[model samples]
Target: MENSASNNILDFLIHLDPFDQLPRDIVATLASTASVKYLAKGESISFHAFCEQRYLYIIRKGAIEQRTPLNKLRARLGEEDQFGFTFLAPLRDSEDGYRAEAIDDTLLYLIPHEHILDLCEQHPELHDYFAATAKTRLDSAVRSIVKKEDKGLFFRSVGEVASENIAVAKHTDSIMTVAATMCGKQKSSCAVIVTQGEVVGLVTDRDMTQQVVAKGIDIHLPVHHVMTTNPILINSEDKVIQAISLMLQYNIRCLPVVSDHKVVGLLTTTHLVHNHRTQSLFLIEKIKYANSISALAALREEKQVIFQALVESGVSAEIHGQVMSMIMDAFTRRIIQLTEELLGPPPCEYAWMVAGSHARNEVHMLSDQDSGLVLDDNASEDDRVYFAQFATRVCNGLAAIGYPLCSGKYMAATPKWNQKVSRWKDYYSKWVASPEYNKLLSISVFMEVRSVYGKSELVDNLQEHLHQTITASPRFLSALTRDAIETSPPLGIFNSLVLEKGGQNSNTLNIKKFALNLIIDLARIYCLSAGGSLTGTEERFQYAVKHGTLSQASCDNIIGAYRFITQVRFKHQLNALTQGNEANNNIRPDEFSSFERKHLKEAFKIISELQDVAKLKFVQGP
Candidate 1:
């Protein structure tokens, strides 16, 4: 029985890819160090503690109950079930280790800690997997258990609390009279212009100023002449965020809120701005006022508050992504400007490129700095030196302004990432033309690149050329689609949550990589394949819809998946930031209510479905 149990443990370790990378001697050492153990029902394996050393414990028979802080919930582990060492291998506090309690009489092999340490010391890559897996598990746990405010944060439907005493004007009313009523009564920006109490036209200060005052139209002109016809309006039951988006998209200050085709109320920029419950006004202000390094740095520090407020206010995930992106862009540009000031002007024409999250404009509270540069084709050695110096300074300055340097140095200073436009085009052509492993990765990275400063045309030209290159190469798109499919959300059979094996977050979800990135990657591949330049995931979906590449229902599903995943991530980060914890994408299950847990599970299910469809569509057989 003992020898059979030992073989089972060895089989389990063999199944884990990490062991396959080890030398035979190391594997033998691990096998010798390991001990087969048996636990009866109610046995406490972890004692609510992480294994001091990395322990690969695999259940040979019976079951192990993984207990949550909330006593009512327990995850059952059956045959071949493994749980241990979530954070023990160079563990960070961010990760959670497993705590195992036996559910039935169970047999297990406790792999020796010394062997684990020795193997990790020999193979840093193996150690890294442990750390990454730990982090991923921790992030997942945070997602599963984190608490969100019960009240609809930002976009609570405006049906009840919304002011229904809306003033309306006829399209024939004089512009001056309408303006007088608005200014005189200190009323919200616009009144619903109704024809027999049915919304026909809406007038606001922006419309009045742009159409009447700016155009020097007579004030005595009828409101019908000045009022915006076919104005963007919202349902009274709609979220205030929907109203805000309508306003921002059209540059309108007010929108008529109609119900059952009857004017019920008016939603104004002022109402949204003043009503603390309506939106994250401070976040908008921060993004608006952040024009310099100091301001940006200040905003970065206050990002937590802004994020929390925004999530609580019910800001739509799409708008939230954009707002965060815009603010990060502002900060990044300011850092680049400050760096330029410190280093003086470059010797030649060059464009600073925002790489990664900033490039995609999907920055979160703890977004890292991912950027590079591109010089003109005809640059001298002296010019290259200057560009390099400027990029180094810019990266350093950015590090100071909250964007930490990437460990891999995927920055402007790196020659691989920074090059002349001609060189960049050559690289793109080589990648698409051949599509090797390194080249495919390069293209994937390039998908997120955008111009932050300097010659935007260079970056724009590169984008156009890359679009042509990718469109010309079907293999490149297929490879990208395969890459995208690799890190899918871990929604298990029966649509249950698949928790990480070992770590502080042993049973959590990685919302960013698994959830958010799935949508992001899908959008990216589809957009690039379709010759679309839209960056934001939601925007890409919309673009696809507009171009007839995807159905409206498909677009809605993608958008819904994105929103559900992002909202949870944002809320998790908000909680961490508020609690003085570093902002991260991992979430624990205990932090969530049962209802939220069900919702999160459903969201991941949607993501998984989308991924399967995308994979089927994009990836071809060998």
Candidate 2:
């Protein structure tokens, strides 16, 4: 190729992914060695391990359609779309033979496989882009986005932010001595007590005040008596996000940071709050300490700001949802406590459960309340009335704090959903035993209930009953599978009526209704069919793979698709918020770059393929 022509090719390559992620000089090298081919309409190229030529094909100006050896259509590729990733790998890893035929006169640039192999060797990060799996490509895409953003301290190792001033004491140390150590030059708020060089317990300033001063216990007593034994510890090498997750999960204020089972430092809520990068991420702590519903409501704007930060930070969707869900959980729990305080404690035992997206821990900006109440079976009529008012206040308070009330009334505030244990079991029994089509919608909302507050055992009992009843019913999964496949991802972007009117001429894509929910619903069917009780969509699919119900490859493909779709939705919503518009699921088509449009089509295809497989696998079963 001439120098000017090579430069033009380099320009196009640099604008594409993987190449765009590469250094310009390297991309220029690839471009200089690239070959261009023009395929007339109806002309084709066949790919297989045995083929002498293996090159990554980039469609420059036209459309192409890939077909399997069985002559079934594989994918439709447009300009900026690339194919033949499987051919870039070793022969043993290549996909089955496929043919790519030109649907229009196509101008294609072919990057020699050997050159890409050399590129991968030089830049190991680029390897994922050439892997035969969508999972690899999607993972690489996420990493690329995160690498571009201002990664927050959440991405840093816990050791970086931990205080090395942790007071080290022996298990046999007296309470008075440990307290003295905490107040010494170290000025530590916590102490790690060890026995035989192993961490055995943890003590904090609160323990000293509460155990010794408040109770006037013997100051000379061994610290072990008042210390929290078998205390939770975090690895120094783990990311700050893991530390945050641990603190939230166990409701702890401090963690002993260990290296090779040796106490190295201490981390506390105080340490986290003092850091600017992570201060705003702890809105859950604020929610917990809020004095009233008004105070919690005031923090709602802060929640949005934290959400924007999370999106900008380019964290994975799972972590993003987990953080948001934790915030929601805090809000709900605090609201329930305030409601109980005002209305007086419940007359009977109960569990406050969340359903749908919240239950799955997939809460986003648009998520609303999908909750229920399971009361103790022996409650009286008057007890029911008191509990009814209690739940109403909690639900309304949640609404006041930015969690909208469920439009479908799948909430504890609804009398039909707030019932005794026996009634809840009966509802599950009726839905599972008969497996009627219309009844599935209501049951599906509560398909994965998680006890957010109160007695968790009550919720566990209901989950066991529901799972057991589902196992006994033969047609329930088939019904769920049928319902799942009722909607298909668009064969093309707009095929599923995925587009809503953006204006007089442009159209917007309803990403949730058309995309995210499809994956969520499929995950539920797969997990429930396997008798697995996992709730999160990604984990449920992995559970399916673990139990031999789904292939690992399929699991990877689906999860990768789910993650990509979620990123699209979140980034779009984040963009909307930044632009002062209401964050929503509807995204305009023109907003997508060539890169996004191409990957989105791949994601849509994966969902469509999985839906087909589910229909055949579950709906066809006896």
Candidate 3:
């Protein structure tokens, strides 16, 4: 039989993160060695550099504020939050260490540093939980949730797995020569076609068999005749999962791995299969072959599993968004194909475009449909009627397969949104010339458009025109900046989260409206001002840095802030789904732990600072 005090400590430790992953026997051992101490409000605790014995302090009640020697607030810890991690290592005499002051009368559980060291030796994963930065801890938290088998695969880079034996050929080389090179010395399945010392095209074994041999084209002709010109390329530094995503998206088995415009290696589907098939890759394949609406709907259940897997695997936020967006793309493409099968081929060329989060490849479970149809200029009145009916079926089909219809009627089903290429150009021109508040909101979403199905050139032309128009109009950029900075991060005085005051979400914070949207706006403003068309938030920041619009340090801080906030929002939604609750953007402050609360405040502060920077840069003085 256990005493009540011991039982209480054990229960609390078992429920906390990182510890929650520990074995029961270890938890019992930890609880047995822990001692308790209480501090009165305004009392301070300090650790000397010369001290031989150190303890990891976990707050059991009240609050403890940890600060640097200069009195800068490093973190604020409340119940169940631990500190003293910095003292785990040996300290030198000249070291200016941290101080913890009790903000309220606090009770703390102290575990010897020696005990923690031994536990870490026994369990290596525990080391990440005690990492110095919030980002590292959040990453570790993500890893802790993943199944053990999947851990090694997610952390490995594409360069490590990609084959170094890259088969190379010149664009002027004969198709037979390329095939012979792939088969003979290179032992490769794909050959890169180089022209003037730059990679111009890709010729795969499939191309040799399908395009050259099957079509009975002259094998003596240049490989460029059969090769895919300007093929998709991946950087060597990108993660393996991203390579897997690109393969699944383009339905290709091979990709050229480039470093500084030079072909370095090749990443193929076989490489991914050797590692182990990720659920995301497999789900996309299943989605491609899914013939009926019911079959596609059944695949929806697997999406939650895939979402959980991706979250737990500790992949970056960009990868998360890309995977989810690819799934949406597959769904849309299949729906469009099925619609075409039912209602004859379209009379003219059209592009089905998805805007907003989906276009940015930042979609999550809560994403709604934001799509439009761009028809050719030559489309007749009868063509408009045909496309309208086609769009209705596609929208309803998407709603049936888990994606809800656009609440604002921004979908192709709306007659106003489904229009000709010339009409879209006029719309973009008008929006830029006169950007009122209501029109700016629509422009912000529409500007991030990507063609998911049909002719992509239509969307590409419109996007190019939009960028050209904005580049020429400084007033439009200023108006966009003013709109971007209109909604600041929900930071209350003293760096607290400003919660909703009333209605269904009373006492909760809308993470999307306050944090995510603000970051997105800043990214958009920076990219638009720079005349860069990248849509993803992180990529936009990187583009800004590359274009000298944003400093490297500022870009890094904003990226970190975006990743942390996005991870928090994702985990919240994952938790809600697991517990059979409706997943929404609203998060109650009470639901956050001390670790989350601290980092979230920091993230909010970063967003606010960046918003100010955007205002100063884009909004000229009157």
Candidate 4:
């Protein structure tokens, strides 16, 4: 074997699937036994049960569109995807024939059939990966990725870990009685308030001190008056991840676990802290009590560790992002608190709002600051000055912890973003009215704003106003749709490179820019066009489907693509972190396993198909 060709082949094989699961020496040996082949566009390779020579064809570059004997399209292959599984079986068990035509100028690595058989024999674990069925192979590949990840943290039901030591009292019970009950022999931190055998509210130990002792409230008053009404509750059968997400979303220490509308137990931060995997709950508690910026900054490493745990927990991307965003929100809220201690109280009412991914609860390790301030409309000039300084400190505090400052300067620190409520509404009205003014970028980033701290109604009002503005303007959706489809996903991978349309190729793929953002942008357009106010990407798609703007099948397909792509991005970043490099979105083409490449090609096609659907529905439709 030629040294250069062997080295190149080994490099490519080392990162591809089933091969990746095998030993390096074995892969190198197989690479040495492989031959290279090229096919021009429209060229076809005809297969039959018996052939003069047989080889497992792994696509090295360009596209191969497989077709049945009748000329119906089968599967399209791209770089890193293999297509010779059916003929790999021993002659006694061989399957029928098919034709593989080059959809583009193509390069392929042909490993002698004997080499694949010999390797699979030595590594029985890879049997399914190279089976005749594509679905089985893909399933095997996905399972391999989760083999080592701890599935318990994400899969365990709430009832498994929740403490059954909850204190329950009637709505008519006096505060003193419920408070005493909480601290009595049961020694629970919270009590569930019920009425007519129906759980109605919740009150925590801290509530006793702040709402009763500090305020000098009459302890004899009904617990309902002091209890948090309609408190967040979790079902006993729900996954622990859902419980964690709820705790983070509502910023509560305990959740009443109800079975059949009856309070059964309590799931508290204390219960979760006992499980090493749920350290996020413990981390949040630490953030709430940190007295200074330095104290809060020291916990940055812990945040990353929890992120690592979350990814390793094998949770879905939506849950992963929700957990991460909750951490971000905790940091942001605490930083504001400490800043206030340093600079006196805020002069007037204001909401510290987060935008983009943060607002959508889809933040990842790569997320940056997309934030702003919404002041009460009555805020004076002096109040504006005060809030501006306040914004700077909070932004700087976030940067110190981990989140990078937005390169586009969309943070609260930017003067334009720190505005009175009316001005903010006016900004949306003007943006929607003048889509021709090229306001898409600004609007796209801030369009998903949600208040993380202070008056949430401010952000809610703005979201409603945004939906109304989008609904009233006929040109806005058309313009937004046009902008949304401007960037098409890559035309699949080239040799050790990503090939976008227009003959451009790069060694590293911008997974966020080319793939993820395109889906995100489309979701935004669909949801907003349907007069929906949902923010998260998955939920927005669900909103579109529920509102009759998107089909349920499309919603499920796109959301599946979104999850797969997100998982790959996170895995890439995780791999980088483990290797001591800074995590990023730029993924090297060769870093993909054969399994990932196969699925990614499908995912890319899904995005491309959805983009076409958007063009016809929003751009070309009424």
Candidate 5:
């Protein structure tokens, strides 16, 4: 029995991330002193109500449900999962320990807190393992909570709200009667025409009014003749917010909800619109009142509240980005105001320009500052000197307002970034007209450029001239493709995930760098080549679809990948912010489920395909 328990304990320790790297002999020594026990469903393991004895636990079999007042099962732990690191905190603060229960009949290996501490005290490596990875498990737990909240925006499943008594119509039914039945029921906005339980077409109020009534068609005409064929529809599992956005976007009043292409129910704008309006008002108010750093600090308090609010409102990510962009813009304007007061008056007329994320108006949660200036090209030499000094003060003040300085030396205060419009045009032209690697990399920065708080005509004219010159060069586009190609995705030989080896983020994949940048780069190229003028990745994809530069399937894959990565990155940043750690984009692969891992791989493959297409079309050699 002792040997059996020891084996289970050793197995569990081998899988625990920080301890997993230790030599086998050391792990074996630790496991020999561990006690493995069985836990029945709903049993309390770390009952602070009973005792203060600290114990480290490794779940060997079965699951544990975390109970909360919100009716939330915070997590269900499985085999080889670790828990009960609360011993690391002071006893007074650790009293609110997690309550564990067996989701199924289960087993756990427990190491006495005293023994664990003793072992760590003896071995520096073991101490490092526990110390470094303690926060990781906590972070993982918090991130799990954040994802639950993020996905909660659409948590209502089709099973919960979908109709059982769906209205149906035959292809041969009279259009007038179908319309009358829909109007009379007042509950049904659409009638699904089914042939052997397979969807053939969908008829709605708009079809009757536009196709039958206004056209003077026969009232007894077949419904199929008037109804829309192959209507755009959504799956029953989709969130109501998405359904509402689709309706608003396509100008359709209702969408058919399908299950395996069989009509399950009809979703209407009325249900979605009511919910959307309520949520959007709350979000707008929250952002407006987030006037100070202290006010914005509440965002880190509720992990995913901000992102969840944006997603559930069903606004396009582009619009959602703009909302964040506007908030940051207001925040920075205040920063400039404070700085101007500190430095007295500017010696000359100059326009402040927000660059990078703010310039693209793609500032979401956890973004830093990027800005510059456009002064009158005709300013005297002495006037230019004073203006530069004023610009430096503004940039420094932005840093004080919680906007961290750019690590890449791309801020407005720098002389290279701040310049006259005529010189800016010359700088842009040199890069666009040249075919060199460094210039192409610099130009890619311009891919997301937008004028914020500047003389509008100067920025507009600069863009027009730059766009005209860049598209004129086949060699420049090729060089851009080459620059984009350097960041090869971190995947194994068979396209399995490749994780970072060491550091605080060992075993995590850098999601934003390897995954999202591919989509962003591809979208940037598409926007440049097609004469489309949007900076955000989603807008570029939308424009590509409308202009026929990208097929529907290609657009779907690209947008899906972008959305998934954005969601993951936002959650990662939220977790970092909560722990008072600097925000970052790296995410551990071990934290994701098998299905999520699969989707990440598929997204990377789609990006690789897009790059291949771009290489063929634009990455031509000299």
Candidate 6:
């Protein structure tokens, strides 16, 4: 029913991002309204304030170079790429230097600026897509992908929104007295039971009604007799969503907030549900109750949806990483439990430890499995066999459900990694003592480890031993410094990007390798040198600054750089996913707008400066 030219335009629009997300009717209307123009080689089109008509230009068949009035090349755009965003809004000055010149005989589709404005008015979200700067468009693209939901309140901290004036009672107090205390304070529905300033239990009105009155228990009994001992608690600084997740997971109506082991406040489901949506909380609950591997795997898609929502809501990278890591922890713990049931219980105590990003609580969608098994020293050969088989099932099951196996085989299934407590200490000692190239790789991966399941003391003891050894050996830290700075941030003279040469990712930057990893390594060096055990990169930097090992100014600069680079990387990955492409860290320079280009160059400069600082402080001789 359509001509070949119209069909061609429609096809092109359907494949590009933002446009790809538009309704079919909108695409059809765009195709109907678009006007075509041809430009000969070396022909230039200049936009100025006096032009009565304005247009959004899309290159249809050839290359176009955008330049400033000073004739500096700003960007190169090809087929399916667009420009002329200034025309979408009114201009104040004619000096705004933007001109497009065709590199060859070029075909272009030009849509009137008024049309774009009309569409933006009809769909308010599209305004970001048509924004004048690349950063704005990129941000808008992220926001556009998320379905509309409750936005406010999720980002607020639990302590800020939680009820601070909570009823408190001693464990020795009578149940009737505790209930009277709660009633006298009209705002309190729950009473926290404490003994010598430590929260020992929690008693709610429901608990009193159900456990006391319904069971015909004496009201004069001490609250501890009817209280839920060792009740789950949340730190005062935790996010509101975390409280919601905890409540849903444990089926508890309320959680006591604790700081310094003392109850500070109370957070109930009523507080969270009053103003926030609990999609992430409910999704985690679904993950917990998932009956089979297939059902668990299906929930992986839902995880992406929640991730998109969180990113769209504009939460910081730290929060994003924390939420993602919590989800991964939930998945890993549940999978281990399921595997244990299928393979039968272990013969000895063992700790399932996660390393790298999961341990640092910095997980993203592309995070792979980096886990190890720490067995009790009492384990025999038979115990090793059973644990090895169990580890295989857990690792294989994780791969089946979206998380791929580690390319370096750092997972628990590897016998070399699955070891007794003493053996793990020996491994750390050997790695730290030698500090060889290959051994440094092992140390870097295994250095920041956290126990996800089983006896946590096994992992804690190993961590303490590692810190002691590293602190005692300055040569090892020097070697680590050398290793950290070996791969410097890719920056060229005159503020250009130094891209990978002649590989599959040629002309693209490996963001993880050149930018993110450098910041991570610097953080690790500073923290380890200070004998600090913090894992999160930002926190590590802060700890070093707090300990006077690193300057606060340098820490702030590096952290800002780290956050920007991470935000850009995440947006790139999000864009790939939105377009149904496999998400990766390889980003083409042309994909970035001029604004993003400027900031990215600044971030790379900051990383380069920090690498030199590390080299001066640790790598060079005194």
Mark the regions of model 2 whose C-alpha exceeds 4 Å error after superposition: 1-8, 21-29, 70-72, 491-506
Give the Cα error of residue 230 in candidate 3, in Å.
7.4
- Mind giving the per-residue lDDT tens digits that candidate 6 earns over 1-622? 5667767788877766567778987887887778889999899898776677888888788777666777745555566567777566676632365788987789998888888888888888778768654345544433433334634566567888878868999999999999999988545889999899888999999998999999999999999999999999999888776676567547688889988787888988777655434554456667788877777898888667767666665566777788777788888888888988888888899999999999999999899999999999999999999998999988988888788999999999999999999999999999999999999999999989999899999999999999999988888888999888777665432123433222132577788988898899899999987889999999999999999889886887788777777777887888899999999998877787544554565566567667777888888563
**Stretches of model 3 off by over 4 angstroms after superposition:** 1-150, 157-209, 216-238, 255-295, 468-479, 486-507, 579-581, 588-590, 616-622
Residue 10 in model 3: shift from native, Å? 14
lDDT of 4: 0.84
**Model 4: per-residue Cα lDDT over 262-325, one tens digit each:** 8888998888787776865468888999998889989988877877877777778888888888
Q: Pick the candidate with the highest TM-score.
A: 2
Q: For each candidate, what TM-score against the reference?
A: 0.59, 0.93, 0.71, 0.79, 0.53, 0.67
What is candidate 3's lDDT per residue for 469-512, written digit by digit as tens?
A: 88888899899988878776654312243321221324777888
| Ranking of all predicted structures according to lDDT, beginning with the best and ending with the worst | 2, 4, 3, 6, 1, 5
By lDDT, the best candidate is 2
Candidate 2 Cα RMSD (Å)? 3.1
lDDT (Cα) of model 6: 0.79
Candidate 1 residue-wise lDDT, 232-341, digit = tens? 77887787566655554454566677789987776656556665644443344444445555666565555555566666665666666666666566566666766677
Model 3 RMSD in angstroms = 6.8
Give the clashing pairs for model 4: 17-594
Q: Which whole-number lDDT from 0 to 100 does residue 7 have in model 1?
A: 59
**Tens digits of lDDT, candidate 5, 316-378:** 456557656665665565555555666676655566766666777777765776766766677
**Which segments of candidate 6 are over 4 A away from where they belong?**
1-151, 156-201, 205-217, 222-225, 228-267, 270-277, 493-496, 499-505, 620-622
Shift in Å, residue 386, candidate 2: 2.3
As a TM-score, model 4 comes out at 0.79
- Candidate 6 or 5, higher TM-score: 6
lDDT of each: 0.66, 0.85, 0.82, 0.84, 0.63, 0.79
lDDT of 3: 0.82
